[model samples]
Target: MLQTRVIIILLIVLNIFHETTAYIFDVNYSYKYSTKKTVYSSVFLQQNKKDFRFLAGAPKTDNILICNTTVCKSFAFSSQNEAGFEMLGAAIAAGNTVGDPTYICAPHYIVLPSFRINGRCFALHENFKPIYSLDNRLQQVKAYNGSYEFYYAQGQVGFSAKYVEDNEFLLGAPGVLSWKGTVIKHTDLNIKNILQPEKVAEKNSYLGYAIEFGEYYFGGRKRRCAIGGAPRGDNLLGQVSLI
Candidate 1:
């Protein structure tokens, strides 16, 4: 009976291995883009019905490439043609559906004249054209008397982002407030910064490393909330905060 059980287990293992190998070896389509010094560090894949599209970030060139089955097109912010302003495609986010608005971020963007390192993000139209910039650098700098004193207060606004609903999303600035991190809620008519009330004397917690939206029940009523991750929080052990 033991011998029979061993044979059955061996057969099952062999079957599973065969299926895995077959799936691994199967390839339907592949695409590659050549670049001189740029690396496709971040990528996003979107699908609609039966069509697939891909978006790749090229930080070195400060550009993004959007590709379909046939061709890939490059995009850049024409007005922001300055050096050291890389990280254009560091973060990308869109809604679950195909027709939803898409956002591309440059987390290290530098404001001119003052050279303040306030990050910027853009919302793209369906044709991949930038509709408007969600920049609060002027207002933020004004609050600090026209200059940022510390590195953490610079407000690298677009380090991370997540889409919640129509014309609404969350933007992360993991460098704000001594790296404790902050999230900005962007709506059609308002932009609000959400900061942690309790201050951590130590720096570099990076609370907004990632973000998402969740729904829960409170008093039997459904409530939606924002969640963020701080991988360096709690003495480098990490923590997730619900907002």
Candidate 2:
């Protein structure tokens, strides 16, 4: 039952979008044996309001420990000296003389650490590439060599100038949301509010809910529906039904 919940939590978080808000301290572990393949492990650093929460899980084993610098625990004892020295060197380079190491140590770990805010958690694939990070905008031109896509569930959509070349994007046909008409002069503008209607849609696209997982209610009851857009024959779009 616990493992099942963990899978659902990961799915919900991956479906939503989030921007970074806090520093993440990550610890990695690897294991190998003659008969069995190596296993992967990691620790997460998370914050809630003013307090912190630490959790440890592993698929192969469940006896995991998440502790701060003062605690001395070990999973792969052989790697301790080398990993410790390397971490200390990194801290020294960052100008910290007295640094204690935080660790996510386990023999066979189960779950990855995570934190949630606004129904989203930080999760990414091993090969995830950051498309935009450089401060200069001019260098971002033609940075992507292939096509990318965006899918919407609910909530406002914001577009950035980093991915756009001439400050324009297509909406709704090949893409679900395209620029209404003109080149977007302000790259920082919220495109959802200013987008033009698609031929099939009655109004400019607007999603009225936050991306989340839980029981959702409509019209204060289950099985109720709400209509979006004005009631003109040309403007009326469709219904949002609660299941």
Candidate 3:
């Protein structure tokens, strides 16, 4: 009798597990948005006063889709005259709270005239309208052989981004300095690179491939730090740095 009871309980548990797995794998309950071969790349959710919005990046078209419960609207890049300015929605980040600004990045955006490939990011207002670009538009001029040449950021900025605080964020440029990578700390008043290649051997390490902020205990005290991932560091063994 004891053995028979144990068998009945085991059969009941197995039946439950089978039903749960079948439900999870059912395709009839899923929703399909696009039939094209485009990647919906990045996604973000924003909350307004009482409503929520869904934002998706469509890199193939250089556009962003802002969706509510009812419909989705497309917003195209404002500056399209520059050649090779692609991948507008490669990265997306939002402010800490609702109604805060939204950031959208295009890691392949090319600067005109000089044709620099520093990439660009747009800051959207609370209403999802672009306020301005976060990248500095200044270009350094150099005199070479009696001719003037313009130089801008060629580090491929906007490959990754994260919101830190009010009017502050971090941007990644994995292509900077022969793919050694670097992270930029941007605030309302200034923007500067916080990560640099410490040695020539660090090249191709890709230090700023990803980043995040977290709190950790050190010396029995809690401290906040920015963490960066170098997936190709140390002969592809990968490394994580804290700042």
Highest TM-score: which candidate? Answer: 1
Q: List the candidate numbers ranked by TM-score, top first.
A: 1, 3, 2
Clashing pairs in 2: 57-110, 57-111, 58-109, 58-110, 58-111, 59-110, 170-178, 171-177, 171-178
Q: Mark the regions of model 3 whose C-alpha exceeds 4 Å error after superposition.
A: 1-32, 35-38, 112-114, 126-153, 199-201
Q: 95-171, model 1: which lDDT tens digit per residue?
A: 76666788888778776666655677777655544433434443442223365534433667778888888888888
Better of 1 and 3 by TM-score: 1
After best superposition, candidate 1 residue 58: deviation in angstroms?
1.7
Q: Least lDDT summed over 10 consecutive residues: which range in candidate 2?
A: 87-96
List model 2 lDDT by residue over 139-237, tens digit each: 112222264312221111211111122222211111122211111112223444223223324333332211111234667865422222212223434
lDDT, candidate 2, at 85: 14
> How does residue 196 of candidate 2 score in lDDT?
28
Pitting candidate 2 against candidate 3, the one with the higher TM-score is 3
Q: What TM-score does model 1 achieve against the real structure?
A: 0.78
lDDT by candidate, in order shown: 0.72, 0.24, 0.72
Which regions in candidate 2 have their CA more than 4 angstroms from the true location? Answer: 1-201, 216-243
